[model samples]
Target: MRIQDAGVIFGILGIVVMMVIPLPTWLLDFLLIINFSVALTILLIAMNTKEPLQFAIFPALLLITTLFRLGLNVSSTRLILGQGEAGEVIHTFGSFVVGGNAVVGFIVFLILVIIQFIVITRGAERVAEVAARFTLDAMPGKQMSIDADLNAGLITEKEARERRRKIEREADFYGAMDGASKFVKGDAIASIIIVVINIIGGFIVGMTMNNQGMGVTQVLQQYTLLSIGDGLVSQIPALLISTATGLVVTRAASDSNLSQDVLRQMLSYPKMLYVVAGMLLLLGVFTPIGILRTAPLAGLLAVGGFRIQQTKAEEAIKQQVQAEQEEQEEVRSPESVVTLTHVDPIEFEFGYALIPLADTNQGGDLLDRVIMIRRQLALELGIVIPVIRIRDNIQLRPNEYVIKLKGVEVARSELFLDHFMAMSPGIDDPRVVGIETKEPAFGLPALWISEDMRDTAEMAGYTVVDPPSVVATHLTEILKRHAYELLGRQETKQLVESIRNQYPALVEEVVPNLFSIGDIQKVLSNLLREKVSIRDLVTILETMADTAAYTKDPDMLTEYVRAALARQITHQFRPPGQPMTVITLAPNVEQTVVDNIQHSEQGSYLVLDPAISQKIYQSLNEQIQSLATAGHSPLVLTSPNIRMHFRRLLERILPDLPVLSYNELDPSVEVKSGGTVTI
Candidate 1:
């Protein structure tokens, strides 16, 4: 009846109960209990110990042993229950009997064993993973962030003083737990010890029971044989099933069509379920040798799928990189073509002329000069050319200033041809792909075009015309068009420069009221002054003047002057009477022009809004009411950017009425042209 005597009595009764009637779930419950108890003991010891190694190494080993035992028990039971007699008979016939290949059967058997091992390993892994989560969840976030110099517990005032008396240590008082090392060491030691102990204890117990004549050993021995044999046999099918199971699980985790809850439910089933399915399917195959071929084929397909995914990802990445590289290349390439010409005069009418330039070392000097000239032209034209295809023939006359000649020309011409041929033997040869002709003057005319030119024209749905006809006459038109496209107007550029030059006094006065960032100083600086040609100056000035409207405060006034001057220059110089302000502008204005004027709050400006003007015509009823109301006797508006239609309301209303502009408007009146503007 004493406490010690009572404890002994209870222990004996408990052992009797366990041995007599084994519960199926009892093993699982017992293992979990042992696992938690072992963990609790180690955790308490770790908290008290200064060195983590004391608790770290032993505890993890104990847990692993518990996991292994649980997995072994579960796997054994599952294997026995799930065993298919039909499947085994099929495996036997297909592998050993029909296939006549014991090697294949043995391999299949080994695979099954491996599969069982994998299931056990997976269960063990999952247990460990869960334990890790528990450990992390219990850890204090702030403690986790503790510095190396810190200890497991905060240093007490007394302890801190004592520690300070000694040398300062670099490492923390509570060293980090070597989880992996402990895991290995604990599992190895505990497994070996427990296994040996169990085997020896079972043998002793068996002999003792036999000597007692209880016949307990006979029953146990039979069960032991059956369990071990079944355990072994179970492994063969398990191996194939487990492998298939792993793949399916991983894929489901990645992209399952099932709802999350459904997927979770499916996952809850022991992964060994897949192993069972795989084994059944494998065994059902008529030929056991098929497993050999089927396994490797399946494995190869899995590997190939992974490789294909990787290759596709890499290709997409490469394509993105190549596109970016091309974009950068386009940005960096020069804008226009300008090189030495070698085409004969007769062929010049065809548009493009080739330059006779060789890649030879000696010709580098000429090439450099040509490149310099091309660069200069690009800067002047605000364009960059990418390619220069040179011709293969050239005729160079040295230091000759002959205007015209009769008889002397024949001898001179023959000598020139001979010299030229000698200089370039490849010239005039039939083997050359390019043309070689002689008649009249001969030289190459440089052509320049910017990428922007092509892109801008393309956006407007127009073809890119690089080399325009009537070079001399069209040069002005080309400049105007380019200026219009880029700076809004050709005159705007000229106006800004004129203001910069003629009104240095006015610029100094009004500039302070204009530029906000002080950048206007550069625009005003004589040092920044470029000796731009008349044409280029006009373009630059116009672009600069247009920016004035948008310039930060301190710039509004100067911008206004620049715009007014630009307007005047575009109009062609005119002297209207100072007393009257006659603003003879386009009648039906573009919406954009109207918007800009409406927003130009710096000063009042005159504009005929197209919408309002059209409304007036609707009210007037006459065909030319819109034009007449806006004071446009003969209405005209035409450009790629602008299109307007006006009925002849004036002619319909009063055909004999005097024409307004020709009669009253000043002949010296200036007009603005080009760009997004109204007539």
Candidate 2:
């Protein structure tokens, strides 16, 4: 072990040894001084610390110091009774420090004991107990706050963990201090008992066993002084330690140390100082106390206040100048432009009237709903959604809100805060009539009804929802639609790292080795674009690992992955025990698409004539319209070879349409052809 660590062990052992074994006067004097130095050091450290946890080891240190003091008392008592003197230190304290009067010395020692045991130690013990109880009680609330901040993306995972750890440490520190304060109280009582024992024992030894033939008065005077001296020596250090304990338990957490906090807070207002100075000067003038006595202090206070006022004024000017300089520098700096260029992945901006929807104090729960939206999307889409930055924009109308994707406005809507949106169920109810509007999310014809009409609307077969729900639903749909755009290279890397932790070998085989992160990101983006859930990422990666050697194209790989996830895709489109209704490509259309397929290094595209493309589009629209009329979603079922090319062809016109291959359907799924797209 290093010398410092070994020294602590040896020192604790030495304290134990001092209690039992007799020591020379010089060594006892040295130990007594060391005890005083240690107590003073602890007090200084307690004063310097801004928070109790900064002195976390103080409880154990208090115990050790108390023990050391007790051992010294024992050694001193032994010497005074056995040899009529402890050391020069004790003798000097008895004679010179107390003016050779035993009674006066005893009174001084008792006063110290009262101040420590009754005042400082007692108050500190109570404070520690209350602090411990409150800290433990507040732990759950503090933990929940941390969790909420984490969910809201106000803090990162590391910060949340650190905050939790600090709370636990505070609890433990206060609990330990509650038990440690008792040691100081007990040590005070022990000091009084030890002193009494030494005096009584000293008197008996001096009068009965002395060969010098000392009288009662002389023996009492001699031994009483030594005993009181010993008491005073021990009590001084104990008092310092007790004061240290009180400071520690009472100290609140702050950014600065104790002295700085005290000075800065106490002197924050110069006007208070000036008023106090006036009061002191008036006391000196009116009171019987002489002007000479208080005049100097009053003048000092007045001058100090003036100086502080002047200093503050100077500081304000300096700060203003510094701020201006910093602003100028920031404008000139290239980094300012760089920061302006950055954009959030998703942003939800609302107007002033919608503030109550995001504010928790006003009973709004938009933030909570946003958290749920992120979690819901993660489960449904298999990607962690980025934090949605929410703020109020004065540029918009009071009731308007907009959702932005990568700095571009994607969707916006208006909401009447006090009304409920009611959408009709096919047939309009004249009784459920209100301000007409369209649903922000689905653009369905809806009515903004009053609070009184909510129950009537529902009873009239119209679906009703609150303003917050409308905003939340609208936001969820927008995010879901643009989730693929949010999954950039960085987000893709995070997803890869997440899976790497669990399936390292599988990730190692595919990522960067066979397919780079960019290649995998493209494949994932393609799936997400088609409203596919990549939640089963391991299967996707495994599929890629198997077929990566044959083709590096992301489109072809996505096709293989789609086929691999046939069951998921089938389950996604076709509900359980339900027949899937889809439009199938005609033989002629399929052959034409295959014939027009052109391949190059940049990947394949269908190079069809404009006339033929128009005919194909018209035919596809007819089939899709028929399916919609039949109350079925438009899904094009084509052969595996042409599915990817066919999707690219009609994506601009029918972006939401699902193009599934024959290989992408599960065998057990029942498929009924809705219509055939023929040209």
Candidate 3:
């Protein structure tokens, strides 16, 4: 062990040994001085700490100090009864300090005990208990605040974690202080009992066993003086520690230490000092107390208050001048305009009436829901979603909200806070009457119904959802639709670094060696654009490593990656034991797309005749409408070679439609033909 650690261990052992072994008077005197010095040091530290957690070890220290004092008492009591003297320190406290009078010394000791045990210790104990209870009760609210700050980007993840740790430490410190305060109270009671035992026992021993021809009166005076001195010596340190405990438990967290906070806060208003000064002067003049005694103090107070007022006025003027100078500098600086060019990746802005949806105090949980949305998207999309910036905008209507992606509005909707949206189940019921509307997410027929009609809507086979749920659902779909735009080269590098921790060789071989971060980002974005999960990055990287040698085209590489993730895509569209329903493209359409492909220096493109493109779009629309009539999603199945080209043709008309090649389907899954698209 290190020297410092060993010394602490040995010191504790020595304190325990002091209770058992009889010590010399000189050694006892030295220990008594050390005990007093340690107590004074503790009181000073308690006053200097700005917050209680700064002295987190105080509870344990209190236990150790109490034990040390008790050991000293045991040793001193033994010496007093056996040797007729404890130490020079105790004798001086008895004779010189108290004027050789036993009754006066006893009264002094009693006063110290009353101040510590009844006043300081009792109040500190109650404060500690209440503080601990309140700290524990406020934990949930504090945790939510940290999460809100994190979601708002006000603090980093590491800072939020550190804040949470501090809150827990505060709770623990107060709880321990609540129990440790009892030690000081118990020590006070033990001191009184020990003093009585020492006096009574000293009398019996001095007169009978070791009297040396002393009488009862002389024996009583000698022993009583020593006993009271011992009580005083012990109680002095105990009283200092009790005061320290009161200071620690009652101190609220602030930026400054005890003295600085007291001066700054108590003297914040200089006018209060003037009122006290006037009161002092009035009392001296009206009563017969004589003006000479109070006039000097009153004059000093008035001067101090006047100077403080003048200083505050000067500070206010200085601040105003500084602010004006800063404004002029900002107007002339080029960086001020440059800062406005930056845009958030994702933003959700609502009108004034929608404030309660994001405010925790008003029962709003939108911030918490945003956090969950990010986590859910991360798990499902295999990419960390950027922090969504949410704020209020006055230009929008009270019920309107807009979702923006990279400074462009992608989706907007309106919500009725007091009503629930209930979508009909195709069999409309006249009993479920309400305001007609459409579901913002899917544009399905819906009605805005009241809280009382929620059960009625459900009973009538309508899907009922609250306003927050509607907003959350709509936001989730918008993010999924634009998940590709959120993933950039930086985000791709983060994913690569995460993979490198586990599969270092695989990442080193694929990234920067065969493909750059931008190349990998493009492939990932292409997958996300089609609503495919990129969570299986390992498999995607392996596929890129295999095909990167022959092709530098990201689209081709993405196609190869999809074929490798056939099982994932198949499971996504076709559930377990369910046949996949899809519309098949005719041979003519597939051949025409393959035939129109032209290669360039940049990349390949499908240059189809405008008439052929129109005919193809019309054919695909017919199939989609037929699928919708049958209550099925529109999924197009095409040849492996023409799948990318066909998807590009339908990108503008049916961006959300799922297009898959035969190679991207698992062999075990059965495919059912829903219809055919022909031109």
Give the TM-scores of the predictions, in the order they appear. 0.22, 0.73, 0.63
How far residue 204's Cα lies from its native spot in candidate 1, in Å, is 2.6
lDDT of each: 0.35, 0.91, 0.91
The better candidate by TM-score, 2 or 3, is 2
Model 3 lDDT per residue over 1-679, tens place: 6999999899999999999999999999999999999999999999999999999999999999999999999999999999889899999888888999988988888888889889998999999999999999999999988876665457888999999999999989999999999999899999999999999999999978864788888888889999988888899999999999999999998898999998998879999999999999998999999799889999999999999999999999999999999998998899889878999999999999999999999999999999998899988889899889999999999999999999999999888999999999999989888888889888898999999989999999999999999999999999998999999987887777666657989998997899999999999999999989999999999999999889989999999999999999988888457688899988888888888999999988899999988898888888889988987777889998988888888888888899999999999899989889888
The TM-score of candidate 2 is: 0.73
Error of 2 at 114 (Å): 6.5
Report how far residue 160 has shifted in candidate 1, in Å. 48
Candidate 3 stretches with Cα past 4 Å from truth are: 1-34, 51-79, 82-92, 95-194, 209-213, 242-254, 260-329, 332-334, 347-404, 408-480, 490-520, 533-557, 560-580, 588-615, 625-632, 663-670
Query: lDDT score, residue 278, model 2?
Result: 78
Clashing residue pairs for model 2: none
| Model 2 agreement with the true structure over 1-679: per-residue lDDT tens digits | 6999999999999999988999999999998899989999999999999889889999999999999999999899999999999998889889999999988988888888899988999999999999999999999999988876665457899999999999999999999999999999999999999999999999999988997788999999999999998998898889999999999999998998889998888888878877887787788889998688877887787788888889999999999999999999999998889988889889999999999999999999999999999999999999889889999999999999999999999999999999999999899988887999999998999999999999999998999999999998999888888778988787787777667657999988987889898988999999999889988999999999999889989999999999999999998998567799999988999999999999888999889898988998999899888988888888899999999999989989888789999999999888998999899
Off by over 4 Å in 1: 1-112, 116-200, 211-220, 226-245, 248-679
